[model samples]
Target: MALFDDLFIRLTSRKVGRDRFGNTYWEARSRKDAYGRPLRRVTYAGVPEASAVPPEWWGWLHHTTDRPLPEDAPRRPWQKEHRPNMTGTREAWRPPGHDAAGGRRQPSPGDYEAWTPGR
Candidate 1:
């Protein structure tokens, strides 16, 4: 299981930094692809669930940051942190007209339609 061992080594190495969710990040010590051509790379450890990473970390992971999240990163006093989409979760929203809620109260009597599939 060298693949797993390599990942464990990379994740626990002192050169890597760990995020709040225990995700690890490390810069490629050398600028070269596996084929040995010059290239830049960053590696991530742990599940790739987007929700597991915070917004600031997400930006850094995508090369938007030359430096890791700063200690002084501005945050408004009233600002709330990002939460992942929960479309299928218990907390997910169900609009008033959705079938889950028995759909919009039946359309008014005058809204009746006679279907003519071909016409």
Candidate 2:
């Protein structure tokens, strides 16, 4: 599937921009999506996950903006660098009680007693 997309992009799309993660963005020269917007796509540098695209380019890719944020655009002081989804990776977050976090759940207070079978 990627092979076909690559061929199509090479033949018909123009390079829009690339994100910090090295993902390349492209738009079709003449093709458009069902919504009549220009066909946009991203060729991920690694995994083909949607999260790989940063918020900066997301708007442009979805046609929400005419162009992606400029390369030199100033980031807000509180803005952090974009990171791809890590749900299944080793660096993924695990809550304290999760098995991967050693399965040591906190104990609850002994407030309620179990009901007796015939009580």
Candidate 3:
């Protein structure tokens, strides 16, 4: 066992719950800090990767939802599951008129205006 694990087991209270990614949470039962003042603490175990948490879990962790997402959250026949943003990737945004295969067509004549220095 790791030194931290050994120390954590000896010092903290009981294990609360674990997420699907193997991250565990431990909540202090006795409300007391090192100085004996009433305090609550939550300890996280495993690699602390924020992205590992799903959107529903994120909402619950931030107290946005009182209940953890249902084990079998409803999915409509037409609804699609959530996907991470990919705006900056190679497969990202391509406007309808932009070139994807080869040279793009020039802008139409009505799309331009003659600029005057004074105006």
Candidate 4:
């Protein structure tokens, strides 16, 4: 199935560009969306997570910009590189009291009371 899909894309789309993460973007050779824009597509380089795409490519993929930002685009000193969403991965953040981190949490400051049914 994957083989056929790859062949279909190869036959029907043209490579637009690749992101820093190695994901390749494509545009259908003969297809257009409702807006009359060439239909855009992406072939994931690895895990197929959408968040893995960088901002420039994201803008192009969504039709927000005519083209993906150039590789030489200006960057600010504080700019950070893109990182994929890690919500379920081992690298995902875990709060101090999260079971994955440890079953212990910091003590409360005692400024509040537990809710009671009659209160």
Question: Which candidate has the top score in lDDT?
Answer: 4
Cα lDDT of model 4 by residue, 1-119, tens digit:
27787788889999998877788999999999998999998888887788888888889999999989986799889988887788999999998999999879998999978899977
lDDT values, one for every candidate: 0.59, 0.85, 0.54, 0.87
Comparing 1 and 3 on lDDT, the stronger one: 1
Estimate candidate 4's alpha-carbon lDDT, on a 0 to 1 scale. 0.87
Candidates ranked by lDDT = 4, 2, 1, 3
Cα distance off (Å), candidate 4, residue 117: 5.7
Clash tally, candidates in order: 0, 0, 0, 0
Clashes of 3: 0
Candidate 4: how many backbone clashes?
A: 0
Error of 1 at 42 (Å): 8.1
How well does model 3 score by local distance difference test? Answer: 0.54
Weakest lDDT window of 10 consecutive positions for candidate 1: 37-46
lDDT: which is higher, 2 or 4? 4
Candidate 4 deviant stretches above 4 angstroms: 116-119
- Candidate 3 lDDT over 6-110, as tens digits, reads 476547655545555555544455756576643322233444445555554565555566445653577779865544455666776677566662546657789
Instruction: Flag clash pairs in model 3.
Output: none
Total backbone collisions, model 2: 0
Q: Which stretches of candidate 1 lie over 4 Å from their true place?
A: 1-16, 31-47, 71-74, 105-115
User: What clash pairs does model 4 have?
Assistant: none
| Every model's TM-score | 0.57, 0.78, 0.43, 0.80
List model 2 lDDT by residue over 27-70, tens digit each. 98998889888899888888788977888898898888998977
